[model samples]
Target: MSYISGARKVRVMARYDVIVVGAGIIGAAVSYYSAKKGLKVALVDKKYPASGASGACNGGLSYFGKSGKLLQDAYDSLILYRELAKELDYPIEICQDELFVQLATTEEEIAELEKNVEECKRFGLDAEMVSKSTLHSLIPGLSNKPIGGAIAQGGLHGFVNPFTVIYGYLDKVKKLEGTIIPNWEVVGILTSGRKVKGVVNKKEEALYAPVVVISSGFETAYLLQSLNLTLNIMPNRGVVLVTEKAPWKLKKKLMGANFGSTGQNVSLCIEQTLEGNLLIGSSQEIGVLIREPNIDLIARIANNALSFYPSLGKVNIIRAFTGVRPHREEGPFLGEIKEYEGLFVASGHGGMGITLAPWTGRTVALMIAS
Candidate 1:
């Protein structure tokens, strides 16, 4: 037990086997699974659950958009999510059969979409080329500028309410007897001679544990910096626009074929939420970490949405918000630090944090449990 004394009273903090930093989807998953394996766990966050990228993303489980090792990881995560949806009491809308439409405006883009579809199929994914007429039949209000497109259907792709998923994980973690500590900003990792100790929060409270996992999204960089470790993680700001509830015209998620095209400075991805509101987003701006909504980027997003669905012009934008995603030029880092024993890192997921959270959590938990 850890104790604190003051002029008025003394308090004791519960001891834990493992301490998970960040209560977002990843951390929640780590806590839930770790506790499920009979490990005493403590989950700490600067803010409440889903206050980070997990809550801010568009909530797309784009299984079709991924390839290679990332795709394999996504497939494993999808399987885990499927089981969790049924196991959790929370109302998580896991639409596994949802269709994914990648719009193409030019013949060159159409060719690229076809190649992408073939590539997805090569990776054992269910994908096909959809003609313009077939695309219209799928999404009626879509702008007719595109000659053709590609579609991924069946169990290939889907989406979920990110907040609901995070809550579900946290609820399960609690049910497994895990402790949650919120409003505590972790300032440094506690260590002695390269072996992990625990963490020191802003209040200078030393929460000691044998294993410590840093899953604090972009903020992981700063915490590691204090320990003389540098992560290639950088902040990538993305803005999203939510529209007022309207008649849902989309039966599936939609995005430009070039949205997944490499080397693009910005891209547009749209999807209708279960609440009947359409989410228009997002732009990849490097180094802008401020959460303030940018009107200029919002306008661009609106214009891009309008270009795809003219009917979006009739929708009233309810609000605009932004989130900072931890990005690495190489991809996510998901293993123990070589120089430090009992310390692990699981951030730098960028925009795919939601999609990859389950696997990341399981991997990190297994690492600690073993």
Candidate 2:
């Protein structure tokens, strides 16, 4: 059937220029750039856009916490996000987040904090030792345990509604003559020899495309596996809580060493959104997990949030939810996977999808454009 958005029809008999499977942040990113390049692209999603981890994530564009190459990639991706926010004119809020990697109230942790502060300064980032008095000036309710830690100035973060980011891209894609099929769950992938042809949708419609990029999160592995491709993707669930509109005790974002409950060494940070709600999150649990929010975990998050701001105790929690991140055994599998010629991957971001989505979209677009 021919669609008016593009010059051509989606042929069941012939292949399209590109087909992007899974319309999460990464997929939408690819589609946004692909359509902008004037490619006949189709963005197919089984559910709706931002229905997965993309929607459930905190929009933290961070350059703290990360040390070596990861830090560098993060900085590069931030640049891409900055460009996209401007070009797209999306409500991308850039905030200077203050990262306080709390010490464990022990002598060893104090030493390590000093060492980390030194290492961070080498990157032209600031990480100074703060006294309890100094810390209270920034965050009055900060835990009285550890003494001091690092502080990177101009730590830029772009906070937007994840759903907005996806839909904004989708809107631009449509304007650029790209096709989008919501609720079009991909059931089967058609391939001949080593080249991909197309996929069978949930409605039993056979759509043809020469290039396919898998941008789905944990569910991507199953979709690829059906096509004889195995993706080493693991589902790690992170939960978050939001409080009713409260006065801003937090001047900037707050990050600690571990979740208050799990103590999993993951970050538990809180940032007040453009809306008055304060987003408190997140506990990182390994392996494919439960959707039901653990009340105990929520309690821990509340405790941790209060540790950063005692006044937060008065704020009522409006909701609790979880978002899954895709983690692979061989680290993040961006670029092309060698197993398939026309197949590409953009998943395995593991809690950093929001931070990585903009550049990922641009990079994947460049790959297909080349």
Candidate 3:
């Protein structure tokens, strides 16, 4: 894009206080928070926002899914989201309707659900166990196969639409006069000696920025190669199946405790979107590049959903797609790098990227300020 300056047309050079690579939820959040801080920020992505996991998520904002610092970060992000919803121009379908329900058809799964409830309660969340009858009562069409279940009740543990969340952040960033550059892939980091300057795009265009935050999942490693930095984040594929609009309204975001029991890394997560379609997901295939829907894996995911709600047997699958979850052997690595000046890192969030996003962005922004 060029503009007229006095006599000749001048090419509009992109420059910023912070150039955030990867316009996924993490990068979007970082751009939102940084721009909110009155900084010139640019949110650049190879594709559009939420084109990754954010587009293919169940959008369960819960603290019980993780332990240790991860759990705390999830809780903190939930609180931050409450404040964020008011700031964003779009509605991300933030509803305070039902609890996060985990059902157990077997004794072992029931035991696991009980343990999860205990962990939630220990973290000061409102949680409890329910018998088989109570579980059925909570979900009228639910199968009687479940021996019991657990519930975590509170404002922080509701469900949301991931697309809106990502766009919400991006929208606010643009409203704040921050640049949203799409289809611009950062092939390498621009550097001069000890201090980093900007980023080099695939078109060989150099966008200048004093500071850079690499929040792109899996691809972060490729950008870090030139800087001699390493963040061990790998790809784990998950297939999400979309069923036809539901004939009934689902009250809770359901999880089958038999998740990943097949040892094929498939999970039993079933939820109804506000659009009335049921999103059934997923499987964990590590280090695989294939995004094609595996027929067998898709069948397993569908069968798992049917196991929970037998009534859904006739529900035709309208869509099925695979999403790559970021996998890290150790844990997610965050904060600014000491070796590279003005270069920060945020990746390896695995399947919990959306869950951990707000806290990660807030923390990373604070790091940039410091």
Candidate with the greatest lDDT versus the true structure: 1
Question: For every model shown, what is its TM-score relative to the native structure?
Answer: 0.92, 0.87, 0.90
TM-score of 2: 0.87
Better of 1 and 3 by TM-score: 1
The C-alpha stretches of model 2 lying farther than 4 A from their native spots are 1-15, 92-129, 259-267
Per-residue CA lDDT of candidate 3, range 1-370, in tens? 6543323333436779999999888898888889988999998899888887677667767776566667778889988877777878677777655677888778988778778777777788777889988888788778877888887778676668778888899888988999999998887777666676777765557777889999888788778876677877787777889899988888677887755343447767887777778889778888876879778888988887787788677678998987776678777888878887999888887777777788988898888987
After superposing candidate 1, which stretches have Cα over 4 Å from the reference? 1-13, 260-265
Q: Which residue pairs clash within candidate 1?
A: none
RMSD of 2: 4.6
- Model 3 quality (TM-score): 0.90
Per-candidate Cα RMSD to the true structure, in Å, reads 3.4, 4.6, 4.6
lDDT of 1 by residue, 1-370 (tens): 3443222122224558999999888888888878888998999999888999888888888766666888789878888888777676778876666788888888988888878777778877788998899988888787877788889885746778888888888888888888899998887777777788778766567777878989998889998998789788888888889999877556588888777443554576888877788888878777888889767778888998888889888889989888888888788998889989999888988878888888888888888888
Candidate 2, 1-370: lDDT as tens digits = 5322122233363356889988888899889988888899998889988888888888776755556766666667776765666677665455535453443345665666666666667776656766666666776666675465445555554455677778878988888888888888887776666776677765446678778888888888888788677768888888889889886645566666432323263455777777678888878776846888778888887886676567778789999888887866555677766766778888887767777777788788898889
Better of 1 and 3 by lDDT: 1
- Each candidate's number of clashing pairs is 0, 1, 0
- Checking candidate 2 for backbone clashes, the offending pairs are 127-151
Against the unseen true structure, what C-alpha lDDT does each candidate score?
A: 0.81, 0.72, 0.79
Candidate 3 clash pair list: none
